[model samples]
Target: MNASRHLLPVLVLLLVTQWAAAQINDTLPAVVEPQVDNNRVKFTSQLRPLRGVAGAPAPFYTYFWEFGDGTYSFEKEPVHLYKDTGDYPVRLWATNNYDDGKKPPTRLKKIKVEKKTMLAANTPPAFFKGGGSLEMITNQMPRPGEDMVLLLGYRNKPGSHTATVSGSVMLLYNEKQFGQNSFDLAEARSYHQEKKIGLDSLLAYAPAEEWNMPLQGTLTGEADSRGGGLFTASGGGNLPIAGKPQLKAFLKEQMEGYRQHHIWRINEVKQGEEQFMFLSLNTLPEMIKDTNAVVTISGLFIPDDPSMDVERFALDLQIVASHDPNRIMLKNRRLNYRFTGKNRENIYKVQFQNTGKGPAKRVAITVTIPGMLNTGTVELVDMKPACTWCDSAYANQSCIDTILTKDSIQFIFKNIYLPGTQQEGISDPDSTMGYVRYKLRFTKKMKKMPFTSRASIVFDKNEPIYTNRSVGRFKKGLSPGIIIGYNTIPGKKPQDILPQNYVLGFTLSEYAAYKKYFQWEIYLEKSRSYESYDGRRIGGDTMINGVGYKVEYRDQYRQQKVLSLEAVPVHFRYNINSYMAAGAGALVGVDVERSVTPVVETWIQRPNGQGLALMKGAYEKQLESFANWRGAFFADFQLGIVRAGPAAGIRFLQYINPSHQRIFLYASWKL
Candidate 1:
């Protein structure tokens, strides 16, 4: 038994080493193959064989194609139609999932279209479908120091007008809420005659036209609003505002919230025609390194013709450390500790992709839920590969079946055909990707600490793939407390001490911390003390004449007032339970104002006690400013809601200089 115990740790270490080694990816390359039929082209990619992960799903490659004409596609083989014949450089980025190797490097191919053979009839006109005018999308989630592409799609409403129009488009990123810039615009490729302009220029390019539109409406309706003559003039003309200040005000309002802005002026966009603009953004090294954190980029389209409505779109992406197909993210990764309780809701999203050569008939995603979150409060917020919830009516149809366990939730995609990344004739990589977002409320009683959850994805009958841990942490919220205390020296008589010390102060600490944390205290103290002694007779003082001298007596009275500023700069505290806590630290204080009042009187009496004389007020009061400095070490214990809110404590302080001790009783309330 002893030998087995000694070898157990060694065996566990070896297993961990082997598992880590299996996760290292190899460097593979993908080559792009394009077939050109004059202005039309059919694009394909030749990929190297993917190294399969042991006991894992079959390895495959997911492709992102940029056709260099401000147009792109996620399909395995996409057919693109060029408006004009030219030499365009096409780029391919392929990611290998379920493979024991690095992502394949990007490949670039230049295709020259010298002849015109295919007409506009070969192109699909539903690029911006379902009445959507502006759309923003990204090729991949951002990884620090990696490059990603963002495509902005804009189109005029199909039946709005038949004439050409000019517009300005703005791309806003690097939200000021984050500490550093997440992405840098490396390059922009616009096939159309789109000219980059400054914010001032974009705002200044106002055309002389306007259309009446009501401002009082829902936010969603305003975003998708088509121009209408809501308010008419005397001659049935639409009410018009000079220079469209409302639109400009809207644009300026958005600009203030972001740190980086890129604006482009697009010219001569015909109605019912879709336009594209591609931007290559490089994730900076200083980007937020939290893998579960999310960032957003917004795109705005404003046509010069005020008759057309404006459009705005936002694209949100998660920051990643690797090109992993299966991952989990927490939308509220950082929460305010003070405001977190049973009523707070946290949203988590789990995304998975089938990277096999064949389609997956059944996909199951098992997520481990943190204990702080209430499992009963799980509600599905959104999902991809959209389907109805599984029930008796949908028993044999495509649906998502959910099973709740004590500590986990399993979402099973049943009776569905989800395409694989390497499946033949599958062009869109998005077809292989699926995700589920669910919101969970916190438990009634929970600790102010970070929690993490992860997902295990299984495709068909293959091995499970584990994703990164999605972490949710509480922000170190501050707790400001009002402190009132009384100080006294023990083992002192009333006449010897006359202790009347009072202290008023405040404390600062982490709000509702479950574990050990530090706190700071500052205090202002005022103490008034009085001491007096009756006259005492001593041996007769020598008289000036060398004869019998009269008896001499003296009377003394003293009073002191001290105002001090005390600070406890270093104090460590730990909660023993919900109501009890212990702490110990040192403090230094200075008596900013000190005043002393001394009164002495002398009397002379005859030796026979026949005569007596009195002297009063011989010595007056003396005051000093900024006189004394003191330091002490202290330990304290608190009771009654020690973690937060109201608490009362008793402290013992040992003064270093003069070697004295004081007892302090205090009450505090954390706000």
Candidate 2:
């Protein structure tokens, strides 16, 4: 057992050693090489080589190199151009296949290259005291297949009155003609000139033909003439006539062209006489396409007399590229088709020169959409501000204005000038300038419907009249009773019935027992009278009588019940709110019905044989019942909490019947 244990340990140790060896064999040895320096080759157009030596030569090799600029190379010798004249590190490596049993290799090195420097150009171009010039300066010539940009500054001399200067620049390519350009610049301030192009004269000049190039030349006229002698010439402000005939002819031709083409006036003569006119055929030189060229300008002053020598005038010139290759040139630029739809979906396109010196900034377009019947959408293809004003307006619309919608579309160009440069930034001073395009759609619905009736009725009854009649005297009257009335016709007569007139059948009523106490009774009433009036009053006497059975139930500190059969004159009673009431009716039955009265023996009496007299007396007393009927107008004052929905109110009724008036309290719920 002891031997086995020892042998086991020995065997394990051998196994571990073998495994380690296998791992080592699996990984190829790494070869570290020196780093190469890139600076040595930067200034020269040559390839730099880096080398690494392994322990011995091996087959199956590959190479890798890391340039400083995040780039890798696989060549043993790598050639690279330094974007700028500077120093940089270069690295390289060579690897052999693992089967070769040799470590991969790497190497690095530093090198230096020298660059040549060039002189600087800072001198400004030559120009007359009154003229200006512009030029560009750069550190070095552009490299092969590279682009360079330079800014040129220009300024005019103070106190210079020169106006209408023309100039051009010649661009030479490899010392060969590349392009020629020209530009016309107007003076910053007005100057006095005599016998010059006046507004009226210029207005008469016809516009040049569309195909005809614009005149590209300068104009020079004598400044104001100095006052001469003690008495200066009175008409000194006007130009003196010199070479009048030639000027006149030139003016006539210009005027004709202006009238034909409607060219606007450039200026008007204010003072001095015509000194000289430099004119050029606006067409480009034919040689421009063949060779590079320089531009030179000259002027001559014409004397009034042909005998006088023509005076020479100083002039300036500028050269510019007539054509630029970077420009995307297009001819007769125009919009082809446009379509606008709801939700501001709009598309539009135009043909234009893209590569040339377009307007200094992008063109701005606004699509104004008129509100349409169904669609409510507006779109601007590409919108940008081309000029200062255009920029302001565009900014205003984007930031300050609330009327613009988010879905609107806009199209814009970075640098371009449109045909109406002069007119731009003039009108709508607050608006932006530039080429603008717009497409808009508007939609919505609007409608309205509107409509407006009166009703009144007047009841001609004794309501108010009767109520007013019974003001007081309640105790002397019969107990307040419920009065009912019916209509009855006594007779039909032509004179008595102008219109439909009917008599009241009778007024039914009930009176309770206790005097000046709470009592309840029932009664019936009728009226016998008929009258009709047409413009005049017609009246006739009538009788109201009726037989009624009544039960009296009274309670006021005492209880009482009364049953009676009586022939009583039914009285018509008018009861208003509270204040007053009045009634009129006749007694009819023969026997005066009675009810048993409690307490001591009650006495019953018969008529006093004053037949009509008794009737009259009863009528008088019962008339007091009419007092109950007295068109009692009770002005009941109500006092209670007012609220929405149903509410109960207590009112004090102060009423006056025909015989008397009293104040009673009542409560009611308002629905």
Highest-scoring model, lDDT: 1
Question: How well does model 1 score by local distance difference test?
Answer: 0.74
RMSD of each: 8.2, 39.6
lDDT (Cα, tens digit) per residue for candidate 2, span 41-113: 3211122221223331112333344444323333334444433354434444333321223222223344443
Worst 10 contiguous positions by lDDT, candidate 2: 465-474
Residue 617 of model 1 has an lDDT of 66
What's the residue-level lDDT of 35 in candidate 2? 28
Q: How much is the lDDT of residue 348 in candidate 2?
A: 24
Error of 2 at 504 (Å): 57
**Residue 309 displacement in candidate 1 (angstroms):** 4.0
Tens digit per residue, CA lDDT, model 1, 430-474: 567777878888887788888989999988998888998888998
* Runs with alpha carbons beyond 4 Å of true place in candidate 2: 1-188, 191-200, 203-382, 385-437, 444-671
Model 1 superposed RMSD (Cα): 8.2
